[model samples]
Target: SLSLRPANSGKVCSKGAFNSCAECIVSGPNCAWCKKLNFTKTGEQEAVRCDTQENLKTRGCSETEIISPKNIQQATQKKPLTRFGSFVDKTVLPFTNTNKEKLKWPCQDQNVQCQPPFGYKHVLSLTSEHQKFNDMVSKQFISGNLDSPEGGLDAMMQVSACEGRIGWGNSTRLLVLATDDGFHMAGDGKLAAILDPNDEKCHLDRENLYTKSNLLDYPSVGQLAMMLDKSNIQPIFAVTENVKSELQKMIPKSAVGVLSGNSDNVVKLIKDAYSSLSSSVIVTHDTLPDTLSVAYKSNCPGGDKPGEEGICDKVGIGQEVTFYVQVTAKECIKPVSFNVGPRGFTEKMRVTVTTRCECECDDPPMKDNPHCNGKGQVKCGTCRYDCEEGYLGQRCKCSAGQRDEEQLRRECRKDNGTECEGRGDCVCGVCQCHETEGGKTYYGTHCECDDEHCHKYKSLLCGGNGRCRCGKCECNPEYEGNACHCKKSNEQCKTGQTVCNGRGTCQCDQCQCSRGYKEPMCLTCPGCTVPCQKFGNCIECLAFAEGPFQKNCSQACPTTKVKVVDRLTLSTEAKKCEVKDSKNCWMDFTMEELQGFDNYSVEVLREQRCPEPPNIVAIVAGSVAGVALIGLLILLIIKALIYIKDAKEWKNFQNEKKKSKWTNADNPLFKEATTTVANPTFSGE
Candidate 1:
């Protein structure tokens, strides 16, 4: 019933075996996995050969472990079964998550998501039209309202109050601050600060109020991020205008995204972001048309922008920036709201984007190219016209005419000669269209369908995928599965997931546990299972009188104890002690003596205690938790040491990155990272 194996040498196991299977050997999943594929075993696992799993005995193992096969030959030689694929691979079917078919392909498929200007994957990041503007805006982003010095002591008190309501720190939330304009602190012109409530100039517009709105006479973005960081919130920034290398240097590398254009290019920039990272959009288009309905997401579902795009970080410095964002009359004039949605399986993010565009999109259309038909592209097109001396083609744009069986092969020579500069033959009096690969057999033909693999002129000649199946490209591995699509499964259960409780492997359409496991999904925690459960008290008492608590022998106690103590313990509780032979003593004192005792207080003392309270269960739980806590503490110390070691080695990594940033790295307007989660405790696990 129990088989034990020790770690060894000369055994090149991909994974250990659960039960004997030639395909598995010392390196494979449990026997149950191989059994499903129809494999059987005999003798030692190492002596077995590869075989399929089928009709095998179930394995005995723990209930909380997922196991898979380690080798193929073990299954075959041991558990001789065959639902075989090919002789090339004789390993047993594994229950593990390892890829059964490791197909060779060109590249990995990536998901698409809009970036910057939208989406924050729990990591704060902003998007803007230009990198310079992004840096400025990020530097000035206010995750929460900061009380102005003008407001005096009350202002400071207000910030403290805000921190209390919001909490000081949270590791999971990200705050994004972005902009597309030049950085400063005001809705109107040069803003000023009014520190006192009594200051008539404190109000906006009445007196350079724009300046006064800033807690600092001139609130820098670096200050904001640092404040936010104190609250455990991270800030990522995106901008347009120019790359603000200075800002990038100040913030964490992962918290920022940037664009090189202006506010007008927001849509295109968002669409081009990569989906592999966090993303956000800070729409600068204040003038939005009511006619448009835009779907804004905090984290770009399609994806965040690719590299060469921006990704920034934040500085956790203070707690004030973790509450309500302080907005001036300027921000009030433009309505802004944060809308978040599910990012998939516990993944959620917020999105902000500009809906307004000031540029006129209805300019005159340019003349279409005769060859490309105005697609703004000219990969393979032809012209038809006579030459003006050395010129030729449909528009006489080339030096000579061309012709070939492949329609695309016929092109006007630009060198003013036939055969395209005398280096090639002329088909239809034109040079052949070339490809990165070697020249094709049908040199003079168009890219349509060919009898073999090449195409002469059909669209998607290889079925859009690379390979040609039945004269058409059959999609590769992942592509072959329902559609020629990529899979997100390669990474396993997305971001927030626990595959099979990390207990057992999914095998043969069922879960297979390791050698010592057993359970529905192999999820049995190592502990005692008591039978004195409330729901099953009667049945458990009869069946498991000795279950988990027999040492006390309360169940087998004397009947008198049960009749009094047991009954009273449930509904009420009191205890009584009676003295025997009192009548004989009373006789000696006579009836009067017995009567005098009535004067004494007749009080009953009661004593109570529970057999279960603070019992084995408590000790077990405490002992386990104590051990785990100690382990966790040790792990933390080790991790800290490793980080310190790395920091000691890479102290200059920060400075080197700064050197590669935008030319305006020294701009004082560029601030460091300040990020915070407005409310930490508010987030529920």
Candidate 2:
């Protein structure tokens, strides 16, 4: 029987440790009985049991029997059988050179640091050796032959042997079996000769198996599951699509792949199996150790809930799922191990629980100050200095050339510790100087001097008449100093003491007159004033005529403007008249004066020579009188004609009377008829 112990135990055991038939048969699945009874559990006492079926039956052992989970659970339910290993005090186990070599094995090739979890250093060596073995098979399958009926079943058995040789202290064992063809198990190959029919004993040659092919029958599925479960090896089958379903019945977790009947396909199938396992969780254990409990948290698909079982759920392709393995050990005993990780991954962690029954402190308290030199107080384990005023940071240390504890502002200072070059107050980090005091102003980086101005005259600054513009004087008018202190001089069309009548500015000492005033000290106006005094007799000029004298008339008086008007029929061709002609030369003049100091406009009649007001009035009166006289003469003529008609009518009447008298003489009857008609008309009344 192969006996197991904790890693801390000094003794070692191997595959061929048991000698008794019953002991060998019941010492887990890796051990088998040899009906020959020639082997001994202790090599010292040989030929002990299992030499033949009679010897095995004499010991009351059944060779056909096997260990299964049912029996293991039954035995465990009776009493808490110690199923774990003893704690190996890692401190005393000096890391030997050989162990270190194993620990650092293949990680060096991948340029990865050798950081296998603590106490699981054997993982690196096991995985490295497994990879090498797989690589050998792959090379042989590709470049050599792999048609043996046993397929890759021998490799699986060899891995079990390797695990037995290299003990996994508290680590769980995992076997990834990948095969394109159906597996040849206990009896399918020539290796079945090792087991006797009556006792189910394994007879081995020096190499531990028969070398020929097709001499054994494959074990049933149930038998394989029982063997693997008893050995504590979780089997992950990577098989072809045809065999995947059958293997899943035996092994709860299996991966399927299409195989090309080559070792290359085997590697691919195993890789696919590992990939599938990594994407989902497949926790194998039904329950954890009683003394220790686990709480799991996985940041993976279907693993969001906390306090779940020790299984990590599915995760995305390149995504990670973190399993927080919290161990609660109430009592210290042997080292306990549990496996947790993706199902088929070879790097699944084997967590070993090592309980420290007693506590030992590693860090001690210090007495000396950490930063401040004995000048400060220590509170809450920190050294705090009594900073003078403004300093802050570690140890209350101020920067160089800065004042300490002045209103808590880190003000920059000179070497003498004076701020702002000792000439101004510091605001923030910069300096400010006194710029004004009543009428005086200070200027400079430090306000050490007054702003410069004219010193030759009695001027406070810039003559107190104009503000200094960028250190240059913009002077007020009539005051012409470089700083507006000197009085202006007169230089105009006619010189006077006042410049521009004190109404304009002097640039380059020249007069610029104010509006409504102009030309050579603004003595001239553009138009004649109302009732123009100077040009009162010059009617054309006063009337705003377009004459040369109209412009000259503006300068003749103190008035502000001038105008002109056209004339007709000059009454007198005088020498002063601009137009000497007598025809259409007389006109008038009306002027608008700026009346008062307010300069309100007032229109005034100035001059008129041709067709002046009185002449126009007389002409209008004479035309009216002529029209009245003509109307009177026409009335007299009408009366005289009426009188002539009356006179003529009376004369004609007298003549008619005469003619009637003559007719009476000539014609008495006609006269008598006239008289008779007149008498008859009277008798009718």
Q: Among these predicted structures, which one has the highest TM-score?
A: 2
* Candidate 1, position 525, lDDT: 32
Q: Model 1, range 90-128, lDDT digits (tens) per residue? A: 011121112323222111232332111100111111222
What clash count goes with each model? 164, 46
lDDT of 2: 0.42
lDDT of candidates 1 onward, in order:
0.30, 0.42
TM-scores, all models, native as reference: 0.16, 0.26
**What is the clash count of model 2?**
46
lDDT of 2 by residue, 466-535 (tens): 6554356666765666767766655542245555555565654566666566755655456523333334
Model 1 compared with the native: what TM-score? 0.16
- The C-alpha RMSD in Å for every predicted model, in order, reads 47.7, 47.6
